[model samples]
Target: MKVILVNPPIYDFSAYDVWIKPLGLLYLSNILKTHNIEVVFLDCLDRSYFETLVVKPDGTGKLPSTIVDKPNILKDIPLKYKRYGINKEIIKNFFLENNDADYLIISCSMTYWYLGIREILDIAKETLKQTKILLGGIYPTLVPKHAYLTFTNKVDYIFVSSNFSELFAYIGLDAKNLNFTNFPAPDYSHYKNLYYIVTRFSYGCHYNCSYCACRKIFPKYTAKTVEQFVNEVYTLYNQTKCKNFVFYDDELLNFTTTKQLFYEFLKLNLPIKFFTPNGLNPRFINKEIAKLMYELNFTDPRLSLEFTSDFTHDITDKKITFKEFEIAVENLINAGYKPHQISVYLLAGLPYETLNDVFHSLELLSKYYVRIRLCELSPVPKTQLYYQLGLDDTVDPLLHNNSIFIFNGVPGKVKPWCSYEELQLLKKFVKDYNESLKQKTIHSYAHY
Candidate 1:
């Protein structure tokens, strides 16, 4: 059997390279390959696309994009609507040339980026009239109802997870005798041209924050053993010669896992750089772990400090407490990391959170480190926050875009902590703080 895997493009006002990869699809690709099925990969967001634009000093760059008409639901928004990928003409040509596929599996990412899936599906249906297509990933897993409404009549099947037993049954494969005693790792051989790769050693978060939908989608908290991680990395580096690896774990620093992973990484002694893009829970950091991180060449120590004080933070769940956050800063500094070398993630534009709350959090963190990464709250389906706000699947997914929260909340329906003008002031404050830090001292830390 021959199959095709596709990573759809994204449509938004702004997008960035978070060292993103279709990890879920890669695992599924591995399963098909092990069954002796021919697999073809077409990654819309692949970094090596020749037409990619806005290349940056960092390995990450932008995809080739074109401005398009805004979705009917989002027409009034002032921001320009753009599609970040090859144009429809090029996409159609691709479909025409690569029409020899029996099954096509399309993967999705954020719920807000669902338009990309709709666009790709249109072309795939027209060019490959007899091909059967399936949809799976974050968008579908989190909001299956919406996925059904949009794609029920278009696609052959919609899978909530990678349960190949059901998927094989649909494809008429008698895999009843095939034993999945051990699943395979993500297949990245097709993406060998990437400069930086994303690696996830863990599956889900053990801690359930009310605002997060991780546990709902993942169902269980599973992790690969230390040996498994080391073996994957060793092979990846040798195959792609790509040294930059960003960990995409939702909770890599919970309990002793981060420290254990560090020891295993050190044993490899390979000339590679590691990073944790999903900010680490500061509560897990200690002198021992910090020292090991520096020795092992882990750059970009991002601390997850959602709010400044206990009162302002979500009290229902557990993460980095304010006290633990301070301890982590102290440990990182004493371990020889410079002030500018460390960064903190602060959440802004919460539904009821005030500018004062954000300012207070920023003040507590600014003294310790000069850089802060601000994240806007984008309520998603299946999260407590969404149900708390009475958000339904009927709502347009584009409203969940983080950038939209900067201007207004839910198209002027829900009230944010601060107004648009207030947000501008906050942005200015951050820019000034970062500028002053640059003038004061240069934190020359080796990254890479």
Candidate 2:
């Protein structure tokens, strides 16, 4: 049997590769390959292999563009919209040359990225009309019903959960003994070396943070054994020899099972640096964990502090108190992490958040000598915040971009949403804050 996995084009206003790689689909490809199944990938986002490349303005890399039918909902958006990937003819020709795909798998990200998803499905239906289509990833997992409703007839099946083993069962493959260690390592060599590896050491989180979809998406919490994860890490390190590694686990500091793994990594004392692109759980870290991370040289650590005030305790996870957060920062600082090395992700634009709230959070993070990573709130479906916002389904999904902060309109305006002026001010404030920190860092270094 032949399987083709695809990461469809991103149709957003701006996108960066940002160490992004679809490990889930590639891992499945490895499994299929191990079972003697021919696996192929049509990575539409891959700039190197794509035929019709559009040189990005910033010049970091190129993005492919293909003229396809735009979704009806986004027709009014005044943007020169083109699917960022090789054109239809090129994709079809590539498929013909590499033909014989019995099954086709695609990965989806942001819930609002369905435009790209729809385009890929239409192409697959037209080109590989008989092949089975399976779609899974963050979007589908969070809003399975929305996906089913939207792509009901367009695609063959949708996998809501992240368990690849269950997918094997759906396709009648025996994967009873499949474990994390047995899972195929991502086929990163197939694409350009991006110098970063995204490895999920744990499956789920123990805490049911109301605003978090981690528990809902991955109901069962399990971490790969220390030996298994470290071995894979060492193997990938030897193979790609990439120095930077990113952890995608919702909770990287697994207090119970995975602490030993991190502890062991500290003992090994590898020189390779580590990163947590997805912020770490502040409540899980202590002096020991902080010391271990410092020893392992975890650069650019981001601690998730959804809100600094206790007012959000009910709606958000109130696991770590303000004092606890300070202590955690102090521990990292004592362990030799520079102030610039630490950052905190504050969900800035929740539906009812005020400018004062945003200002206060910034002040708190600044006091800890940590930079702030501001994320505009995007109320995903199934999460409590989504229902609280009462988002109109009729609204364009493009508006769902966190950059827009659609839910958090103004305080007392007729629209009852964040005003354009207010949003602009918030953006400016964050910009000024970051610039101030950068200038301060330079001045301090000069004095040193």
Among all candidates shown, the one with the greatest TM-score: 1
- Model 1 pairs whose backbones collide: none
**TM match of model 1 to true structure:** 0.92
Worst 10 residues of 2 by lDDT: 407-416
My TM-score estimates for the predictions, one after another, are 0.92, 0.86
Q: What is the C-alpha lDDT profile of model 2 across 216-265, one tens digit per residue?
A: 77788777777878888888888877777778787878566656888777
State the C-alpha lDDT per candidate.
Answer: 0.77, 0.70
Off by over 4 Å in 1: 51-58, 162-166, 172-181, 314-316, 411-413, 441-448
What digit string (tens of lDDT, one per residue) describes model 1 on residues 36-64?
89888878877666633555533577666
The deviation in Å at residue 145 for candidate 2 is 3.0
* Candidate of highest lDDT: 1
CA shift of 296, model 2, Å? 1.1
